[model samples]
Target chain A: MKLLEYQAKQRFAAAGIPVPPGRLARTPEEAAAAARELGRIAVKAQVPIGGRGKAGGIAVVDTPEEAQREAARILAMDIRGYPVRSVWCETGLSIDAELYLGITLDRDRRRLVIIFSAAGGMEIEQVAEEAPERIAKLWPDPFAGPQPFEIRRLAFAGLKHAPELHDRVPKLVSSLVGLTSRLYEVATSLDALTCEINPLVLTPEGNLVAADGKLEIDENADSRHKDIAEELARDETGDDGRSGDDPFEVEARKRGLTYVHLDGDIGCIGNGAGLTMNTLDLVKQHGGEPADFLDIGGGANAERVHNALEMVLLDPKVRGVFINIFGGITRGDEVARGIIAARDELHITKPLVVRMTGTMEEEGRKLLEEAGIVPAKTATGAAETIVQLTRAGSA
Target chain B: MSVLVDRSSRVLIQGITGREGSFHTAQMRAFGTNIVAGVSPGKGGTDQEGVPIFDTVADAVAATGADVSGIFVPPAFAADAIMESAAAGIELTVCITELIPVQDMIRAREFVIRSGHQLLGANCPGIVTPGQCKVGIIPNHINTPGPVGIVGRSGTLTYEVIQGLGQGGMGQTTSVGIGGDPVMGLSFPDVLQRFADDSETRAVVLIGEIGGSDEENAAAWIRGTGFDKPVVAFISGRTAPPGKRMGHAGAIISGNTGSAQSKLDALTAAGADIADTIEDVVRLTAVRLGTQPR
Candidate 1:
C-alpha cells in the first residue's frame, strides 16, 4: 500500500511531526479551493510510484487558477505505468536549506536505519549512486531510540548550511523514528508486507514533511486488520469483489496455490508458486492468455485437489483447464484421486490437460489413463494442449 | 552428526493453541520429533496431542527440560515469545511466524545476542535434521536422512531442491530453511559454518534466491575457509526482474548486484558447483557424492 505524498504528510502530522499544510484534490475545482487556502502552492500529481517530478507530475503555481490548470494536466497524465488519479496542493516553503530524511529496513544488519542528506528532492538511489559521501546514515537503538549525538553528526554532515535547524533535527529524527516504529507495528498488526516513506522534507520555517509514502498491507494478514479489509473491499471489483483478480488468484500468492482470473480462456493449475508463475509465463509465450493460476500446494491431498479443480471450473471464462503438478510430498496418485473426484462430482464439461511429475507419477498417470485422461510430458506440452483444446472447443 | 537438530532433541511449542501452531506441531510429532511440552499463556493445564501445556515457555522448559523451542505465536506477540524463551535459557529458538515488525525483531535480536541464545527465524521455516527431529512446518514425507547438508532461503524452493535430491536418490543429513525475512536470526554463513564442521556431512547443497548479501557473504566465507566437501548450488528467482521484491521480505533485489544472476556469478566465482534446474542440481550433487543419480 503506497500512500501518496499528502497522505504520508498527514500521517506525519498525526505523529506530532511538523509538515507543510497540504490537501489532496481530484478535480480542478478542488485544486482551486486548495490553492486559495494555501496561497502560493506546489501542485503535484499523487501516485504511488516515485520519480513523479522528473516525469512532469509536479509544477509550481502562484494563483488558484494556475494551480487548477496544473492539477488538470497532472491528473490527466500517466506517469511510470500508474494512472494519475489526483494531485496535491501544498503551501510553497521558503528554502533556507533542503535536507532528506528517511527510515527503512536494513535487512543485513537486522535493524531499522535512519538516513539523512543535505541534498533533497532527488532520488535516494541517484544520491547513493552519485555522491555517497553526502548521505549520513544511522542505525538507532531500538530500545534507546535515536541519540542526540547521532542527530548532531547527521545534521552537520547533511545540513551544514543551516545551523539554526540543528537543534530541531534531533527532535524531527526522533519523531520520524517513532512514527516508523509505530508504522511497523501497524504493518505487523495488519500483516502488511511493506510500508515505506521517502523524501521527508524540511522547510525554512522549521517544519518537517513526508513528501511521499507507500504502504502495502499483506493480503495474508487481511483477516487480522479490519480497516485494511474494509478499505480493500470498498475498492473491490470483478466477480470476487476484489480490486482485481490477482487478490483472489491463489496460484501466484506466497502460500498455497493461487490462480488469478485473467481475461483469457485457458485455466492453469500447477504445484509450486515458482513453477506456477513460470507455467503462466510459458502459456503467455505460447500465445495463450492464461485465464487463471492455481496451485494444489506441496501436499495436494484429495480435498485440496478437488477444491482447486472446482474453483477453476467455477470460472465461466475458462474454456479449458490445465492441471500441472510436480508431485513431491503430494504424490501423483493422490492428485489423480482429486482430479477423478472433481471430474465425477462437478461434471467437468470443459477439456482438461494434465501434467504430473514426482512421487508415484506412474501410478497417477495409470489412474488418469484408466479414466481416459492423457497426461502431457512437459509444461509446454500441457499449455499447448490447453490452447488447442480451447480453440477446438470454441470452434 | 548434523547441525541444530537430531532425534534426541526435545522440542517445545510456544503458541501451541493457535491453529497453525497446533497443526504443524502434530505434523512435527508425527515425523518422530520429541515434542515434550507446549506453551500458550492462558491455555495451561490443557494438553495438545498429549504434550503437556504450560503457562509460559519458562514453565514448559522447567517441566519438560526442553532445550529447543519452535514458536507459532502471532507477530504481535512474537518478540515476547522470543524474549521469554531466551530468558528461560532455551538453547535454540525457531520462530515459524512471519511479518514480525522490524523494530520488534531488532530489539528481540539484541536481547537474544546479549543473552547468549541462538534464534533461527522471525519469518522462516524451522530447521530439520532428517530421520531425527523436525521442528518446523516442512512436508516431512519428501525428506529422507542421508549425508548431504542443505540450507536455503525459500521454504518451497528448498522443498523443490530436496525433492529433486530425493528423486535422484541423494538424501540429506540436515536441511535448514533460514527464513526469508530481512532480519532473520540465522544467516547462510552461520548454517554453513555448522555444515562445514559436522563430521557426518559429506557434501552441501546450498539453495539461494535473489535478495540480501547473505549468499555473497557465504560464498566469501566458503572461499576463504576452504571446506573440502563439494557444494552444489542452485539460485532460484533467476528470471525474476530486478527491483521487484518477491513474497519474502528478504527476497528483494534492489540494485544490480542483488539479482539472481549476480548471486550465481559470485557463487560460481567462489568455486561452488552450480546447478540450473532442480533435476540438474540433484543429478550433479549425486555425481559429486559418488552416488549415481536415480
Candidate 2:
C-alpha cells in the first residue's frame, strides 16, 4: 500500500500541502518532454523506497538531453530490488533550507503523531540519532487532530536547533501549522499509516514546498479506499507495478493468500502469523534457511493447501516445504488432505514435512500417514525433519 | 476464578446468523459458556439454536442481560459491532473478526474506552477459561482448570501452550490472545495487570512476536510494577526481516526497536525468563513451577 513519490505528491497537493510541480514520466522521452516543460528539473525514480539518491535512482538535469539520459539510466536501474518503471521529473527549487515533517500512527499510544524536524536534507544523516532533541513530536488528539496552538509549539521545539532561521520564526510557525494540519487531514482521509514530506523546502522566496514525499496506506483500510488503493497501487512487478514483487506473491495476492518471499531453501507455511514466523525461525534454528513466510490464515481446505504448496514450490530455490499448523479454526484432516492432494496433483518431489496439532489432528495425522507422508510431533521436530530432508536432497 | 470469562458470565454472539457466528456459537456453547442471546440486524425476535436473536446489542443486552459479547461479524462491519456492544454497556466485548480497518478500530477502541468498557481483539482468538467457558475459537477440551494464566499474540500458539502445558497437567486459569495486529485491544501490560490481581493465577507465560513495542512495554510494566509471578516469555519472528515501511517507523519511534533481540533484552533486564523455542517455553515454565515438562 506504499504510494510512489509522484502519487504521494498528488495527494499532498490535493490536501493543500504545496509540492513542487512534477510530472510522472514513464520513459526517457517522457522525462525529456517533462524537462523541456518544467525547465531545470530533477528526475527521481518512482519506487516506494528510501535512499534512492544514494542508490543512483535520482538525477538532476538542467538540459532535456541530460534529463533523457539520466531517465534512461534510472529507468533501467534496480533500486533495492524495485525496478524503476518511471521517473518523477519536477521543477528544481531555489537555494533554501530543508525541513522534515511526517505524520504516522504511534502504535504504542494508539494515536497519530506529527514528526517535525528542522534538520533535514542530505547533509545531516541520522538527525534523530545525532541530535535527538532536534526532532520534535506532537501526538494529536485522535478525536480532534492537531490544534494550531499545539502545532506552533511543535514548530518552535523542532526549530530550536536551527537558530539561523530565527528571524522568520513567525512565518515558519504559521506555514508549519498549516502544512502539518493538512498532512494530518490527508493521513486521516487516506487511512495513511505514514504520510511524510522529507526535506520540505523553505524557498528563498519564503514559500514551503514538499521536495520529496511518501504515503503508505494502511493495508486493512484499503477496502474502504479502493479507489486510492487501485489508483496508487505499487507497480509490484515493474510493469504496471513496483519492482521486486515476486510473481508468487502476485499470484498469492490474487488468490487471497498471505505469503512473503525469503531467500532460502525451506518453504515454510503455518496457520497463524506467529506460527508462520515461528516456522521460519525454527527452520533457521534447525540449520535450514526459510524460502518464504506463508500463512494459510485459518479455515484451510484442500484447494488452499494446494495453492500454498504450489506457491511455495514455484520458487526453484525451495528444496523442501515445511507446514506447521497449530489448528484452531482449520481442521487437521482438511489440512492433511490438502497436503496429500498437493503432493499427488502437483507431483511435488520436494520433501514435505508437516506438524499438525490441535482440534481433530488425530484424524489428519491418520490421513497423512495413510498417504505415506509422516507428520512430525513438534514444530521444532518438523523444522529438524525438513532441514534434514532438504539437506539430504541437496547433498 | 478465571480472570476474564467463567461459567456464570453471560455471552452473546453479535453476528449470530452469519456462518462463523453460528458455527462458533455452537462451539462456545459446547464449551459451557452461558449463551444468552444473539444480535443480527434484521433477524430480531428469532432464535438461532434456541438463543433469542435481537436486532441490536442494546436489545440483546436488555433481554438476555448479556455482559460479554463475541463479535463474529466481517471486517467491514466489525467496528460497528464493537461500538454497538460498548454503547449497549456490555462489560467485555471480544471481537474475533480480523482485518477490520485500523481507522475503524481506532474509532471503535476510542468509543469503547470513552464508554468505560474493555474491547478485546477485532482480530483475535477470544478469551477462554478452561473447564468453565470458551468465548471465541480456542479449541474446547484443551484444558483442565489449573494455576497458570496465558496471554499471547498468536491464537494458534496460545492453543499450543494450552495443549502442551494444560494437557500436561499444568492447566491454565485463562488463556487470552491479545492478538497479533499492531493496533489491538488489551496489550500485554493490560492483561498482565489482570493476571496480577487474579488470586488463582500463580504464573504467566507471555507469547510475543516481533512487531510493535508491546513486549517491551510489557517488560517495562513487569519491572515497574514489581510483578511477583514467574513469567516465562517466548517471542516469535526471530528470523523475520524488518518490514521496510514499519521499520522506518520503528527507527523513528525508538532507536533499533521492534526486533526479537530488543524485546528479549528488555524482558531479560526486567527479570523475565526467555524461552527460545515453544518446547522451551513449556520446559522453562515447568521448571519455574517446580514441575516436569509433560
Candidate 3:
C-alpha cells in the first residue's frame, strides 16, 4: 500500500526521523487553524501519487487567510486521477540544500539498496537519468543492517558534486548516517518495499529533516503489519487509495479477488495471474477491448466463480466475459460447474464464452454445452467467439 | 533424466496438515510421487492416512530419507520453512507458499545458497517431471512424458502451454515454475541450465511476464553460454498498465523497464522464437523441434 505524505510522516515521526511538525486538514477551516499554530506553512495535497506540486496541488501561505484559501483551492483540485480530499499543513523549512535518500529492493542483487544523492526533491529520477553519478548506493546486509562506514562513504559520494557542502562534509555525513539508519529501521520494521525521504532538507541551522516522505509497504508482507495497515484503512479521506481506484477494482478488493478494471467491453477471467493477463492480450488480439482483468485463482469452485460473474457484470460496459481456465490445481469441470450455476442463478444475460482445457476438460466442455454456453476448443478460438458475440449483440 | 525430481525422489511436505498442503499432497501422491514422511511441528508421530508426520524437518529427513521438500507454510513462516528445508539437507526445496516477505526471502535465499541447496519459489507452482515425479501443485493430468522442457513465471499460463503441447502430441520432460515474485528462488537461467543438462529435454519453452531482469538475464545467459537447445518463448502482460501489479507481485512495469516489449526484444535478439498466444507456443515449439504438429 502507498501512503500519502502525511501518513508516511506519521511513520517517519514514530521512527524518530525528523519531519516538520504537521497536521492533516480535511477542510479549509482546519487548514487555517494549522496555519495559526505554525507561523510559516506549506499546504500540500494529500494524494498517494507524486508530481502533485507541479500540478498546483501545493501552496505556501504566510497567514491563516492565505492558508485557508490555498487549502480550499488544493482540496477542490484533482491531480492526475486522484481527487485531493485533504491537505497537509506543515511548518516551512529554512533554505539550505536538498538531498535525496531512499531505500528499495534491488531485485537483480536480491538485497535492499539504499540510494543517496545530492540531487534530491521530486526530480530524483530525472537527475539519475541525466547526471547518473550524482547518486550513490549501498546494498546493506539484511541481518547486519547498514554499517556506519558504508553509509558515511555513500553520503560523501552523493555530496561530491555539491562543492558548497564540501566544507560541511564532516558534520553532514554524521547526520546523514544517523538519518539513514533511522530510515532503514523504518523500512525493515514496516515491511516497506519503497521507503524514501525525498528532499532530505538540510537547514542553515545544521539539521536534516525529511521534507517529504514516501512509503510503500510490500503487499506480500502486509499481514505482519496489521496495525499500520489498519491505521491506513481508518483514514476515509481517500488516500487509502481506493477512491483513486475504479469502483470495480474497489469492489474486487472487497471481494478478495485479483481484478484490474480496464477500458473495454470484454470482461476477461482466468484461473491464474499470467493466464488472466494473456486473456486480456488475446481479447485485444481478436479486436475486442478487455473490460477488466480478473484472476479467480486456484481451485476456484462454484461459489468463487458465482461471485466473479456477479462482480464482472456489475459494470454495464462489460458486454461479454471470456473465462479461460487451464486447470492445474483448478479443475476445468469444477470451473464449468461454477459458470453454469452463476449464469442460471443470477439470470445473467451477457455472453460468456469459456475456453476450458486440462484436468477433466472434456467433462467441463460437456457441461458448458449442456448449459447452452459457448464452449471453445482453443483460447484463440474462444477470444474470436466472444468478440464476435459481443459485437453482434451490441449491433 | 529430469531436472529436479524423478520417480525415486522422496518428497516431504512442510505444513503437511494445512489445507493447501493436504490437498496438493493427495494430488502429488496420485501422480506417483514417492510420498514419504510429513512435518507439522506438533503433529509428530501421527499419520495422515499412510504418510507419517514428524514434528520437525530434521526428524522427517532422518526417518524418510527425503531429499526433496514441498513447503506449504503460510507467508509469515515461509522463509523459516525454506530455511528449515535447507538446514535439513534437502537437495531441492520447493516452497508453494505465496506472499513471503522479500527480506525474509533475502535471508532465506542466502542460507539456501550457503547450504548449497536449490530453492524453487516462495510463490510458485513447483517442479513436475511428467510421468515420473511431481513436487508442487501443477495439475497432474496436464502433462505426459516427452522430449520438451518448459519453464515459466506464471502458473496457469504454464499449464496452458503444457496442455497445448500435450494436445499437439508433444509431451514434456519437465516443467519448472520459477514463480512471479520479484525475489524468488531458481530463476530462468537456473532452470534453463538444468534443462540443458537433462538429455530427455529437447526443445524448451520459456514463459515470462513483465517484471525484473530475469527474462533478460535468461536471454543473456543463452547468448553468452551458446546454449544449443531450441527455445520457444511467450511473454504475457503486453497490454498491462505501468505501476499497477497485475495479480502477481512481479508483474508490474516500473519506469521504462520490465515491459513485455523489452523482454520480447531481448529474447528475440537472443535467437528465441517468440509466440503471441498459447496456440503459437505449441506451433513454435514444433517448428523449433522439427516435429509435425498433430
Instruction: Give one digit per residue, the lDDT tens place, for model 1 in B1-294.
Output: 879888878899998888778777877888899999999988899898788999988888888999999998888789889989999999899988876766577788888888898998876667888888998877777788888999987665677677778867878889998877777787888999899889889989988877788888888888888867888887765655565554465655677766877878888988889886666787788888998887
Query: Lowest summed lDDT over 10 consecutive residues: which window, candidate 3 chain A?
Result: A236-245
Q: Which 10 successive residues of model 1 chain A have the least lDDT summed? A: A236-245
Candidate 1 lDDT over residue span A1-395, tens digit each: 43456655565566555567788788988999999988998888866667788899999899999988888899788675566777888887676555666666666677766667767667777888988877877776766666666666655566554456677766655544544455444434433444444555665555555555555544434455665445433433112331222444533343344445556778877775445545565677677877765656445688888888888776687888888776634568989999998998999878988987765688999999999899998666787778877888788
Q: How many backbone clashes does candidate 1 have?
A: 14
Q: What is the Cα-based lDDT of residue B206 in candidate 1?
A: 89
Across residues A28-131, which tens digit of lDDT does each residue of candidate 2 receive? 99999999999999999888888999999988899999999999999999877787888999999995798999887778888778889988774333886789
TM-scores for every candidate against the unseen true structure: 0.81, 0.93, 0.96
Q: What lDDT tens digits, residue by residue, belong to model 3 across residues B71-109?
A: 988889889989999999999999888778888888898
Ordering by DockQ: 3, 2, 1
The global Cα lDDT (0 to 1) of model 3 is 0.89
Task: Please provide, for model 3 over A33-142, each residue's C-alpha lDDT reduced to its tens digit, 9 standing for 90 to 100.
Answer: 99999988999998888888899999999999999999999989878778788899999999698899999999998889999998888577798899999999999987
RMSD of 2: 2.9
DockQ for each candidate?
0.30, 0.55, 0.75
Q: Rank the candidates by TM-score, best first.
A: 3, 2, 1
lDDT, candidate 2, at B89:
96
* TM-score for chain A in each prediction: 0.67, 0.89, 0.93
